[model samples]
Target: MSSTPKRVLVVEDETEIRELIALHLRREGYLVDDLGTGDLARTQLSKQPYDMVIVDWMLPGLSGLELTRWIRTELKQLQLPILFVTAKTDPEHVAAGLDAGADDYLAKPFDTLVLMARVNALMRRKSWMDSFNVESEQSPHAHILIGELKLDRDAYEVYLRDEKLDLTKSEFKLLEALMMSQGKVLTRKTLIELIQGDGVNVVGRTVDTHVFGLRKKLKDHSELIETIRGVGYRVKLLNG
Candidate 1:
């Protein structure tokens, strides 16, 4: 964790639930930001940065999914931890929430323990990634150049043929890991740990979806990332 307390934004339409969530977070000593509508949340998000956000699946002004998409696509805060809370407990609903970019989900009427557990886990994951990036930046060699693809660890950016690439945080990390490993194939579980932090229970399939998105963004250079059937993925070995 940083020297300062992590700030969290809670976006729930219910005043009671919003306050309750904030109360629980404050009890744990986190700074809290609250919003009752998605639009207001969006505006606040643009003006400030929060360490995490807890969003309701249903909200006024915009649904949770829409707000999540806006954060990812517009704000480009792909690394921000999002915990989606909703009454919808169906499998498809859960899948939709994850696909829409939530790092985790909690059903309504949730126990504070479970909610706090997820929140703590996400914070840990964030800390781990931050530390990992710092370590990478400290490395004397901070770049991987493969054909038109280049990932610069110094600037934390990716470029293809000199054009900057807009990749989500996970996608950028995934590509970096793969390109760095080069010929070594990485299992889904291994890739999860490499990107999301060990013991972070992200659904294994989430790696697939992230890879799918990364591949699409890579466009004509997408062929460089090779799927290894049941094993996982690897960057194809380059010829001498």
Candidate 2:
């Protein structure tokens, strides 16, 4: 029997573009839902969960960036992968999209092949994460506590001094890897491999971005994640 197809939501205002993307995604065996407005998309999203979202920066109501922010803050669905398809090709715009919570960005007039590749990569990464969560739930080292920091693998939650921290999926994975290999420096290449899975074309700098975000959220205890200069990162060893 075939497994259930991964579901994808495409939020694009242009009918032709939306249909084109939906067609390609469906051809790749993905069950896709295409919406023309961010507000309608948000409503649909609230009713069901999607493995990934492909959104255009411009929308009739609630711009794609605003929708992304809502998904991260209001809906609190940090694990859902978001890919931005936009005409804003400027580096600043791209950075803004990333900062707004998009997992990947593709400028307008994008090549279908590249779009498919990015979608597949994100899907693979999400699949690995889901598997990790399941396996961790069954393992003895499912929960980790170091000093005032606490991580629950089963819940995919992190707490510092008893206060829960909201983290993106990438940030959560980075912290999990460091805590799992506590006190040991993990090279960027190794970290990427562990977090993104094999065969993904994730750059080393992407790891840095996630670590930066993770540390910022770590707040006062940010130093708990140590940067090893040219090497990588490690969780500080706390004496019990």
The candidate that wins on TM-score is 2
If scored against the real structure, what TM-score would every candidate get? 0.64, 0.70
Give per-residue CA lDDT, model 1, range 132-205, as digits (tens): 55655334336778888888864558999888999865787688778867887988976776555321355679
Give the per-residue lDDT digits (tens) of candidate 2, residues 1-240.
028899999999999999999999999999999999999999999999999999999999799999999998788786688999899978888878887778888878999998998888778767655665565543533677877888886566899987899987567778887886678898897677545522135678988888899989999888889989999999989877
Let me know the TM-score candidate 1 reaches against the reference structure. Answer: 0.64
Q: What is the lDDT of candidate 2?
A: 0.82
Which ten-residue region of model 2 has the weakest summed lDDT?
A: 193-202
- Residue 70, candidate 1: alpha-carbon lDDT: 89
Alpha-carbon error at 223 in model 1, in Å? 18
Candidate 1's error at 14, in angstroms?
A: 0.8
